[model samples]
Target: MALMIISSVVATPSGNKDISVAIEEMERANYFTFVMLINMVPPNLFQGNVTFLMPSDRSLSRTMVPAQNSVMDLLLRHSIPSPLLFDHLLHLPTNSMLPTSNPDLMLKVSNRGRRSLFLGNVKIVSPNICTHGYSVRCHGIDGVISIEKPGLASPITCPRVASAAAPLPLLAPPSPSPSPSSAPASDPPHGAAYETSGGVRPQMELALTTWMAFVWLLYSKAKLCV
Candidate 1:
């Protein structure tokens, strides 16, 4: 893949004449960028001449594509699925928009004449850049048709943007009361010393474990227990 030189029309379907020379014809007229992409494509895949609704260097540059494989997809999107020429365009009426190779994209033709050709909102600069056999009418447009810019999104391919996090699910919590249970009223062995008899201890019913301990101590003391 030279990425620059288009070899022959032998790569074209139906054994069309070598349009590579015609591509040069276009290049001489300063319409090289669009034609060059056509040349980069292998002959087997690229069949015949079709009207190329070309975006100018300015239009192509405006596209913020990653410097990688995505460029290939962008190229395919610009090329129409079928072979069509300017003559074909003349027959089409106003507001006639044709679908391109890409499902998202569509080529629109309006205001067609010997003076100019309009694709979508773009003005076609070079009519019949390579119109010998099939045709490669290169048009110079103001901007490229961005199909996947806003709509196309996949689970994996789309970016993990900073979207507002979903509200968390409410959860159930435990009660504040400790386990309500009574303990046996019995004193510990003689050696054990307990703090009591003077006044009532604080109603320290907090965690389950603390509540249990309070109950056990209260049982050990006979009256005024804890």
Candidate 2:
């Protein structure tokens, strides 16, 4: 943004004047709110040859001030970048569009004879409040011009976000099965003859041999007696 240095000078009838004089005229016109608003602006702004559309005291008092970011936008909407007086504006045909400091907004002129002149929705109640200088000009308007936000005029669209797909979960391995041959053996009953390694029991065989020998001895004794 370029800086506008306002230098004060007296306004001559020949279209030569200063910005400070114009501001003084605004104070005299009972536009205290409008004057205060302009004073709030930094010295570096609204620097070039400019025109101001000031709202009346009552109009400014009733309306709330715009936010800090919006204050510049609002001021720009009301002002024309070039110096324009009531006479210059009067020549414009009906529906003539005038550009402001802000490119998005415009001031439309509505000329309806001596009774009324309008810039957009607000009527120029007091025309040419300050025409003392060639660089600065001011006029009193009936109401405040509605400020349209640049963001709202052209809607901002958000780009689509790409999301990554989720990863799959892992599972555990299964256990091995047991073999049938490894099962336990069954138990045997009590008092049964258990199998030995070589032959039959020795006690039964000895008893049979003794009985045979006794029989033989008795036979021999009987024979000798006869």
Candidate 3:
């Protein structure tokens, strides 16, 4: 049996316009290739708000399409889960990573001056292509969004602080106390000539000896006269 490929979009439980309306809008904007690719997926798979980035029909034909299992990834790479207009996109700062329907895919934004803006490798050529509905938004891009492997981490280097050497212990030399030999001599008490080692006073001994001599000479003179 031949493979039967069917594409249709149904309304979500929230009563929003079906995603098919946005696909039709892409069809009107000369993005028939992208519309067909979306049509290949079952409508039941789509839910919530979606923003589709559609390249020109020529760009799609020139680029190779992915395998059946990878087509969903292709669509996810080009689509953001939220509806954003060109003005909204312009407000996004440079290097802002916008999440997509698929958790693994993220669209990096590069904002240049004026109307120059980029989403991943694709450049927004036409802005606000789908603004009629609330659930989906579409815009024209210059090229297809590139699909690359994830999980590669950026390199980081930690800075080292300057270490100071520990301070050496300070040693102060001790000073010596003053000795008696180094001290100046003080004057003795008045009337005392000097101090003797035997502790006797020389002035008292001289007075006693002079008295005895006087007495002896007197006695001798008297005896001789008698």
Highest TM-score against the true fold, candidate: 3
Report the lDDT tens digits of candidate 2 across residue range 1-226. 1232222232222232366787788988988877777667776566648889998888877777677556666677788888888888888888767778878777666888646887778888788888776688898888888745222123223332222222222322222234246444452321122233221333334445654564555555555435
Give the TM-score of each candidate. Answer: 0.48, 0.56, 0.58
Single out the weakest 10-residue window by summed lDDT for candidate 2.
190-199
Give the candidate number with the greatest lDDT: 3
- State in Å the error of residue 33, model 2: 0.9
Per candidate, the number of residue pairs that clash is 2, 2, 0
Candidate numbers sorted by lDDT from highest down: 3, 2, 1
Off by over 4 Å in 1: 1-19, 39-43, 112-116, 135-137, 148-226
Model 1 C-alpha lDDT per residue in residues 116-180, reported as the tens digit of each score? 66655556565555555444444445567555443222122232223322333333332333322
Flag clash pairs in model 3: none
Residue 162's lDDT within candidate 2 is 25
The lDDT per prediction is 0.53, 0.66, 0.67
Q: Quantify how close model 3 is to the true structure by its C-alpha RMSD in Å.
A: 37.8
In Å, residue 60's CA in model 1 sits off its true spot by 2.6
lDDT tens digits, residue span 1-226, model 3: 1233222233323313547677677778888888888877766556647788888889889877768556676787778878788888888899767776777667777889546897777789898888777677889999877755232111222322122223233333223334446344674332123364322345445545765665565565555445
